[model samples]
Target: MSVRPPGECTAPDRRCILVIATVASFLTPFMSSSINIALPVIGAEFATDAVLLGWIQTAYLLASAICLVPFGRLADIHGMKKIFLTGITIFTLSTLLCGLSPTVNALIALRMVQGVGTAMIAVTAVAVLTAVFPAGERGRVLGINVAAVYTGLSMGPFLGGVLTQHLGWRSIFLVTVPLGLIAVALTLRARGEWSTPRDERFDLIGSVVYGTTLLALMYGLTLLPEATGFGLIAVGVVGIFLFLWQESHTESPVLQVRLFFENHVFTFSNIAALINYSATFAVSFLLSLYLQYNRGLDPQAAGLILLAQPVVQALISPAAGRLSDRVEPRIVSSVGMTLSAAGLALLTVLTEETPVPYILISLVVLGTGYALFSSPNTNAIMSSVEKRYYGVASATLATSRQVGMMLSMGIVMMIFSVVIGRVAITPAEHAPLLSSINLAFMLFAALCVVGIFFSLARGRVREDPHRA
Candidate 1:
């Protein structure tokens, strides 16, 4: 086993570093979904179509995926602190620009820049935390970090709705400015050190090629429902091939395709993550509309109701992580995914007149399942790689997550568009919209079922085993 050098600080100091890193990680998801509640208002203001509206979220996901690998490598080359601070600065500035954007085009452009900043922070966070914490404590520290992420995701809708209703949608972006400054201050105060600079070089060509490929594929996916022309298919197929070729030949490939082949644990964890996230993305995105349009819930009520999932997730994640440290991650992850799929299946019976209690129960079940699944699953992924390669490993996992989310959004939108197109009426008409959302939920459940299979396939590894 290859044991990397521990962090410079003592255990207590390392704990502090974990706290700081967790806080920084929170910014990404908080910003990502907080904007969802505001999309309607923004869409109306900009006269954006459904297809163009999708870009608001897609731009962020695409940019983040494109930048994660390169930023991770940069963290290894220079220092995590330098790259992290730069990212925070950029994120804060771009958020301000987003708040002030006068047009849809400008807002989309600024969001892409914001996503770059988010990617930098996100890609570095897990590596930094792993470096600070000892192997034995890694699972707990990561669990807390995961909890923070879910907390942010849970709070996003409520915050967004409240702010948009009272303070205007722009306030959502404005609020992050101070939080960003606070995070920067804390990071500076934290104590941790990296090794001396090595003779490493960034793979600029690989980064560009990978970025272009992901952009093309994501764009094609986004456009597929509206424009099912041959051009979209051609772009997706060609882009995917080029991406594969680039990764195969590059000396320092961005994605580390070899790792996927050699490590069964890594492969299954990524597959499970992708499937789980796709289901999550579909449910959250569609449910927001379902609550508001079909059930006559206001944005604030809808947000509050959605909070059920994250609240339970926060409650159960630590326990799940601790359990994984004792048992096989495959068992924990498989059971969790199964529970989540069941919860989503329950949602298939939802109707416009469904009781609020039933909806909350379903959400709680989903949240519990997610909490159980996420921490253990992430622990498996992070533990599989050598400590020195934590940066790349974490980046790959994060990229998988973003890709899943982006794909889920695209697929859900496509399905919704098709379902709605068959009806000669607007989405504001309750019955047709409810039917569409029901179908979407059923599709999401099916994806979760696939996650269960992948989770089961993740062969057992010694929990927190020494890395090579």
Candidate 2:
């Protein structure tokens, strides 16, 4: 468990690794974004309720959140390339099965499996990128990685709409198969492998406790306003305390508990990430429904409209990343958080009669803010850690993201459960749905406003001696 560099690699090896990681990065977000567009269609085809439709997304995120930390530790101990390749193979095959799923239940099950693959890819890609690149180049490289993610998001809505309209929702999953295969094939050809040379045993007991606790917490959130939900949440809170105690005593903890307490930059930066994602991840989910159900737009039209935010995100992320290389990342990210809050505030007034241009303008603002925040924030977190912690660090950051996403959706599902009930999105249900969306926006905007402080409080990453 002593500190050291994970491994070394040549320039060519760096290039190959980046390509594989970027491709893998692009894969998950594309499916996630596209699937949002396909949700209405999927719901109709299955004759399911709104809460059930929300579960389609929740199941995948829950599974990912549960596994991310464990897989990340495995990557650090075993080998990044081995885990990365396996993840791609699992994701691609599971995606195909998801497309062929016979029922809603089957689709949700497969999505959980797909999420396990996502957990493997999510934790390792950044760790691999960090392993190959030096400190000076970290921001630029990570920016490109973030850009690839936004690019997948950019294509998802437009292409997902087209596929759903023409071929059905299944086509959205089927089309990603080729790209996943390409990443796998290229990974096989890459010769470099990286891992921390540690003899520490994997913390199986800690992993189990962590996963089960997170599951209870997330599931409880979705079932809010109910007695069972409150009871489960209380159990989750107690489990968290137990998990922390277990980690502190264990020789090889799955999560490094001290990182949150001892490391100033890592702790606040991760909290900022958690808050930022919690505030922003549901914008598209709410907007897609707003455009289609309330405004009566077709999936294609709604998608084209919803495409604005991620398109701006994809466009600006690299530049923002490069900017972070020069400026203080906290400063850059804090401003972005402010802008995101402003955008969310604007959306709080959305209605059936709200002008299309106003909604588009709000999306543009959110996109700009997100682009500004994401890469710099990522650079800060990655730069704060030593090379040996890269895999766990990456996993920790990804865990924040996945957990935030679950929280964002959990807010929506809870609101839906209370306001709109378990009904389908028929015209009679439109008023309640609109109210739910606006209320969610109000809560999210407040969360973003609170996150700005954490972003600024992370202090300076460049000052950290371990940055190299």
Candidate 3:
């Protein structure tokens, strides 16, 4: 689909796209973050160890990471509306299956399917919004869409905890079914499908190689500090070289590997995104454990305490998005990264005796920093790439975010293996847990420091004329 000039689109059509994007955006994060609060409950019910329990989250993300790029390409070749609706249907059905799952293994399998659907929705949503909105309004629309993500995150904990506490963890999935249906309804109410006109063949080999590469890399990250894990990491690194070679030689690549080497703005922006998510994604996971297990708070209290970060993100993201339209996104994004580093550095010192107020303040700082960073950074990335690459570009950025999240979880899991062994988290293990959390934060903080440089190094972004 060619980019629609801003004014050429009917106002109703713009609203329809934005509304569908916003609603669809909310479902994934809400489900993910809310599920984070319920992890302890799920783990206990399943009688599974932490490593296995981690798969509940990892499997979905892994599946999404593997499929997003290919699905994005598919959307461009087929139609975004068809892919988006199919994803919504599959995700809703899988969510119901998840709620009914009698076993952890079953749930994990369902989640993997859910992840495939998520990949479809995630990539297509960005492609559609960028396609319909004009350049001048791009940042603002992207910001609003991003804010919906944060809003979902913010609501997930408190609402999820309430449902988990009252109706059991299963209710969380049930509740989302309605929301998913609503999104589907809104999307159906919208008029037409958006997709680039194309006849290019799908690169099946490249897709397989790309998927396998991510699966190996993410799995390796989870097994870190183990000798075998190091071997796996080596294998994954080799896979990367192979994937790149294939992409270069393929007639039509699923991912334009050349962009990473050739497009300075795109490369640095994606790297910056990876760093930012790697540094930040694990915050709530660590904190939920810290609050509930170490600090002796219940799930409800823990959820409330964890709510501060995304709440700030929810509040500030749209404004930051609007700001990026007028100023350089890198300037805004670099400052945000610096602030995130500061917030994370402060968090590294957290102990059992740390005051609640201090923790909340740290969360606020981190949240504020993230809020400023995410939307602007996203705007920079989407704005940097050409219109033809929109689906791939969107998928690439989303993939970086998911991959970084997997890495974040891997870092935490590795620390858990080293610090606490395979035991279930106990009060006796709180000190080691603190050590793990602190270690994760320190690593994350350092990553943010590096991220700020990448944020700056992205060349001055040329405004996308497709939008203009």
Instruction: Tell me the whole-model lDDT of each prediction, alpha carbons only.
Output: 0.77, 0.88, 0.85
- Candidate 1 per-residue lDDT over residues 1-468, each given as its tens digit: 322344557766676677667877787788876787777667667766554566788788778878887787777777776788788888888988899999988998999999899988887777777766678888688768877788788789898888877888799999988888877777777655532333576778777777776766666664555565336657767876777677788776666777777788888899999998888775766677677667767667777887788788888888998899898888898888988889989999888888989999999999889888988998888788787666667778888888888777766656645665433233555676678678877888899998888898777766424344
Candidate structures ordered by TM-score, highest first:
2, 3, 1
Q: How does model 2 score by TM-score?
A: 0.92
Off by over 4 Å in 3: 1-19, 130-144, 185-192, 462-468
What C-alpha lDDT, on a 0 to 100 scale, does residue 149 get in candidate 1? 87
Global lDDT for candidate 2?
A: 0.88
lDDT of 3 at 285: 84
Q: Candidates 1 and 3: which is better by lDDT?
A: 3
181 Cα displacement, candidate 1 (Å): 2.5
Off by over 4 Å in 2: 1-18, 132-144, 189-197, 386-390, 460-468
Clash tally for model 1: 0
Clashes of each: 0, 0, 3
